[model samples]
Target: MPILTGDQELEQRNRLPTLMEVLGRRTLAPVDLFSFYIYMRDQQRSVDYLDFWLDVSQHMSLCRHYVRELRRSMLVETPDMEKATSKRSSALLENFGESLGEAESHPSSNEKRSSEQRLSAFLRHQHKDSSGTNQSPAHSMTSQHSNMNFSRPSHEPKPSPHSEGPTRPSFMGSDQPQTDSNSPGHTVARQDIKASAEKILYTFILPGSEREIVLPQSMLNRIIHSIEEEGRDDPEVFDDAKDYVFQAMERDAFPGFLQAKALGNLVPLSVLIRLIIGLASLMAGFWGGFFMILRSIPRHTRCWLILPFTIGCYFLVSYQYKIDVVAAYLGFSEYTFMSWARIREPFVRKLLLTRAMMASLMFVAAAVALSVLFIFVPGADF
Candidate 1:
């Protein structure tokens, strides 16, 4: 029924949220968050930004994974933020008594106990406990329920129903209730706890704007600073800021970011072409120098004599990433700073030409040296 994809839309359009909306989801699956952007932006042509998305997903995954680990290590009564949350929860509860005055008639003891039980169950669900066994909260609750059987005989130590009035609700010194494992309320509370955990992780891992795509460095710095400012009120703000910064800078992290495929490693096809041109120049120097030296013209012709040498030298000097094989062989002391000539931004191709010249000189020199050494060596049979 949609106008966008039309007939094609029905097959692909499953009523998914927009990219920005997915990115802002309260509970985001790491893969879903990243794929949405790639699908929206037409990834094939936007190869450069692929690294950016990879970084975002990796950080999100890591932050989510680490937070789950942190939560798994904590008990409801002993959370990582024990000192802070304890004080805050205590302070807030002091004012809760008045709010409960009206609800007291509805069996407040049972209600308070229920809330505590839910909290305990939430924690148990997150962590398997110290027993090194896989005991579920429902299993434990079932066991406790079985132990509370009120069907004992009259002679058994059961107090008379008339003697025992309703139990007084004591929020301060009582256990919380445990809802029926199959009840919707229990499922909803469990989901709420999970949502809260994720939010805490999100705040801890990405305190900033947490953009779906990392922007330019200049923009990122501004966002980071802003997030840091906002994090002042939230103790977990640092973690969030750290997560974003880590992801933004992660491309340069090498092995850790091996999958990111950043451009820094991929010299542009144009740059590669330039490098090839430079390599070819090395040949020009070698051949030019050899041909000039081969012509038996008088040495007094400085201009003619120096032409090949100069040509070869130019190629030698033009080589990039320190490509001066001639200099290395001759042990010649021409200023090595010339080697950096290839590395300058908007690279100079002169080095390529120079490298060829150097190659020529070496060929000519080796040829002449071999001819003389063979003719002059003191042996005998010549």
Candidate 2:
């Protein structure tokens, strides 16, 4: 493949809208349609990201099927269109004319021809349903409203029977090579493979504009070796290469530290505030209920104590779970590892963590006071 120059790239970009216009023209040939699909897929890869891989894959599959259908229909219909106008004096009239007699004389062949023609017509007009409701392609290329169906206008002048069907246009072939029927879309498939490979490389490289990572020399060497053996014939080598990448990424210690750092930095102020509010609410609810049960039940009827005890236990378990989750997210070893005495914090780490702890304790105290006022003080219904 020739390297695309800066001017060539710009020209390709500008030609996109026109190429789309050409594809939308009802005069598109099979080869033209196929080329359009290939270009569309390549363009899609450039715009689509890793998160949308599944959607892109599904769309690619649909495009392949649509192109296949277009090729089949063109093969059957274009030749039939040619034969239809053979007896006509004007070759230009041939493009639109149908040979009813030839279709009739073929016996079982008539049914087959008719069926093929009907299929072709359906493929041509499939964008519009019988009720004239416009439908998107099998996979959406854009917003449904943005995707327009291109159909030949009934009043458009057609070629005479003596004339040939429209010759395939030239502009479609600038960067695209001529496609042969037996090729089975090698270019687009190869493009997808390359896109996937690049994505894999990026996954290991780690994407961040702020800094370039210096991976371990051993790991880097392993990655290079893996790339070398990517498509080797030996199954063991391929598996080993895959394993090497997996192991490099999966190495627990380094990633664990990086994750610790990321978790520390990424935890938002709102999340810490929310955690404090939640814990405070829990403590208030639990303690208030505990004291209430204690006052209401008789000392003789000790079984009533279990209700408040159960409530306290439930609160404790739930709060512990919540704390563990938050602590993990905030880069603490565990909930119990909150204080510097238990677990050391980096120089500036306490700024956020300390605030979170203070807020939590205040909430806890407020909840306890509220519970005391409600349970012990008389006429405190509100």
Candidate 3:
């Protein structure tokens, strides 16, 4: 686990590695990932970013849904359009709705403080409380998650998997026909997309809304101009905002979550198991080396372990391919970056599972060869 500090600058650096690190990652079900974090983030009063992100991201799905509809209109040959879209629609939309379901409720109560205001207040308090000038947000006495004690609302239902903003529409309009419908049936047309985009602008981009987000003035102006000028319904309208919001989550919100969950220290069981398997394969390679060594010197006994393991490994590692290809192709893959968050559980699991299985086979070969070596060499205690 990384030592979180009072220094905000150092904390930022600590989070940078989250993007590249792909080793033992815990893949949370989309529901769990969003629900848990949103709840946790809510404790800090910073749930707006996630809420905004979640809402904006739904547009991407709406875009895809539109594409499938367009494809059907064109009579293109395709399969399984609704098969994958339903769960995702719920995962994305429901969460946004659930979290912001209380949109009518004003934040006048003490518990409903602004996340940025609360965070800044905490920082100011910390500055006065301690002589130390620099503090990472995670370990800062005033940071949001530190005060929550990691409690969550158990009875409350979790919303769908979304980032912080309203959902955006996608540009691609080439999806298949949905013969059978499912839950969260978000069949968006151009007008619906335009309306949703306008709502996002009003809530997040426009200045007067209660949930107004902090975006660069120029970028904000650009988005406002694009949609308002032509009354355009392009899914790409929210593209810049999406990138900005995703980065904000990566920089600010994610670390607080890691700190709150203490996920840095806890490895998911599946990932750990796969890691062991991958290492086992490496160990098996050593046995293969032993086999080569024993073969060179005329081995006296035909040990069952050495020959079998060696033969098994010969066909194992050479032609290996990603095992999760089918899952990915079928859209089990993570849709948005923020949905996966910093740990990227699903992505890492796919990598480890594929590599580990192949490595495990090779591992046995190496182990057997090593055993044979010890058996043949007298008094060679390892």
| Top-TM-score structure, candidate number | 3
lDDT of 1: 0.32
lDDT for each of the candidates? 0.32, 0.33, 0.42
Residue by residue across 21-98, what tens digits does model 2's lDDT show?
223231122112232222223222211121122222222232333434334434455566654543332231222234
Q: What is the lDDT of residue 171 in candidate 3?
A: 17
Tell me model 3's lDDT, rounded to 2 decimals.
0.42
**Tens-digit lDDT string for candidate 1 (1-382):** 2234223432343332233233332112211223222222322222223333333333323223323323332334344566364453333232333323333333224654343333333344333322323222221222211111112222212222322222111111112222233432332122222333333334223335222333456554544453344222111222334345444433332222211111111112323443565456545544544443555333343233234434433333333323344433332212112221112111112332344456556656744543443333333222
TM-score of each: 0.22, 0.23, 0.36
Off by over 4 Å in 1: 1-50, 60-69, 76-298, 307-310, 313-382
Stretches > 4 Å off in candidate 2: 1-199, 206-214, 218-245, 248-312, 319-382
lDDT of 2 at 130: 21
Q: Give the TM-score of candidate 2.
A: 0.23
The local lDDT score (0 to 100) that residue 199 gets in candidate 3 is 66
lDDT score for residue 104 of model 2: 32
How many residue pairs clash per model? 28, 16, 45
Cα displacement (Å) at residue 350, model 1:
25
